[model samples]
Target chain A: MELVELLKTVELFEGLTQAQLQRLAEISEPARYDKDTVIFEQGQQGDRLYIVGSGEVVVRVGEDPRSARTQVYLGRGQIFGEMALLDGGPRSATTVCSRNGTQVYGVSREAFTNLCKSDTAIGYVVMRNMAHDLSFKLRHHNLTLV
Target chain B: MIYKVSYVVSGGRHPGAIMNEYERPQLGDRVEIGDKVFEVTEVLEMTPPRGDFQYLHVTVRLVDENENP
Candidate 1:
């Protein structure tokens, strides 16, 4: 899929216009990871958000890094590390490349912040979408605990 | 068409995922999700297909660990 098209599918960029998605595509960097690669460690500071472009990655949340438990598997169009970008806090989970040749588009928080300041619309829409994502995850988590 | 399947486990310990798959998932199919394997029990169409993407909500049950292992 085209880069801008993929960006449009991302939940965070759901309501963005074509021009806005094009602007985001301009700042996104492509990254590739091999199988079993640790994309980010839990508690690590993250400055960029990743959208899975191809293949898959896993999110592991627990005290032990080697914990077999995996919280979520992210595939094409799924974004991770957005919470860190929004809250400026350490990563709440570790992300690993579970499939070989996993690819992602990385958007730096600094770049996104600048874009948001320039175009308030992008910021507003994405922030709202992020809220929806957080709510969905929280509900799923609470349901799991029940 | 790439179907974006969100496999939610029904009364299971493992979390499900949103994945891009070429083939559609069917009920009673045992698939590995997260670190554990599960059997698909139900499939719901959350949204109709848009362009090349289709979204599906799948409910899966954990297969007996001993049976799968």
Candidate 2:
């Protein structure tokens, strides 16, 4: 799918207008990762959010790269690294390509922040969507602990 | 109510496992299958029943506890 169409399917971009998505698409850079490739490591400085374009990516947590545990598998339309983008914090988890031809679209913090600053409407919608996504994950995580 | 759940370990050799899904498997749920402990990291999909409205089908991905801990 086209980047805009793919962004439309992402829960984080849900409710965003086509024009907004197009702007986002323009800022995004396409990337590819081979199977078993470590995309980013936990604790690394994070400045980008990645949207899965195709293939699978796994999120892991732990200090050891050789044995870090998997935390989740993200497929098409899913996103990662938004926490760092929003907070300017280190990466919370490691992400790796789980499939042979994993593809993603990445948006840097600078570009996104600039976009948000230029357009508060896009900023509001994007932030709200991110909040919703994070809240849903937190809720589910809490439920599992109960 | 008890529900059956199946999960696949991302980038691992294990073929995954089936277990009861009581609490609705969420990210970070520690699950045990045989001697291996896995952490629930993602919910792949959930399928509701067709006609009679029975159990829902859920697929999840997990990673070994050794890696997560």
Candidate 3:
């Protein structure tokens, strides 16, 4: 699938115009990983966010990689590692390629921020959608703990 | 057919919609999120298919503690 069309399925990129999605696509780099490859380890400094293009990726967390537990399974059209891109923080979890030939489209913080600077509309919509998703996640996590 | 699912587990929605395995998950199948494994109890259409993509909402519950992975 075209990058722009894949971006359309993601909730975070919701509301972007075709032109805006095209701009994001242009800056994106599509990468493929073999099964079991560690895409990024928890606590590592990260500047890029990835959108899965095919196959599967797993997000897990633990102080030690061996002890880490599966956090979520991400597949085509889903975004992982977004928090780091938005905040310049260390990765909160380890994301691994769970299936062979898994592919992801990555956009670095520098490139994304540059695009955002050039088009505030992109920044506004993406940030707003991200906030909405984060709030839902926070709410769900807190409730599940009870 | 491409079936993408958003899972709601143990009475709360998962932070994000997370699904895209080649085989569609059916009722009684197991799902994992975070450290928890859930059993699918209900499946509903979240939205109609968009081109080749079909969206679904899967409601599940934590399996008995003894059944955990």
Question: Candidate 2 residues A1-146, lDDT tens each?
Answer: 77887776566776678899999999999999888898998999999999888777777788898887656556666678999998999999998887777889999999998999988888998888788557545543333333
Q: Name the lDDT value of residue B69 in candidate 2.
A: 53
Q: How far off is residue B36 in model 3, in Å? A: 13
User: Higher lDDT: candidate 2 or 3?
Assistant: 3
| Candidate 2 vs candidate 3, TM-score winner | 3
* Candidate 3 lDDT, A1-146, residue by residue in tens: 77787777776677789999999999999899998899999999999988888778888889788778666677676788988987888999999998889889999999999999999999998898777556544543443345
DockQ of 2: 0.07
Instruction: Between candidates 1 and 3, name the one with more favorable DockQ.
Output: 1
Global lDDT of each candidate? 0.80, 0.69, 0.76
Could you tell me the TM-score of chain A in candidate 1? 0.91
> Which CAPRI tier for candidate 3?
acceptable
Among these predictions, the greatest DockQ belongs to 1
Give me candidate 3's interface root-mean-square deviation: 5.3
Error of 2 at B48 (Å): 15
Query: Which structure is stronger by TM-score: 1 or 2?
Result: 1
Off by over 4 Å in 3: A139-146, B1-4, B8-17, B20-40, B44-57, B60-69
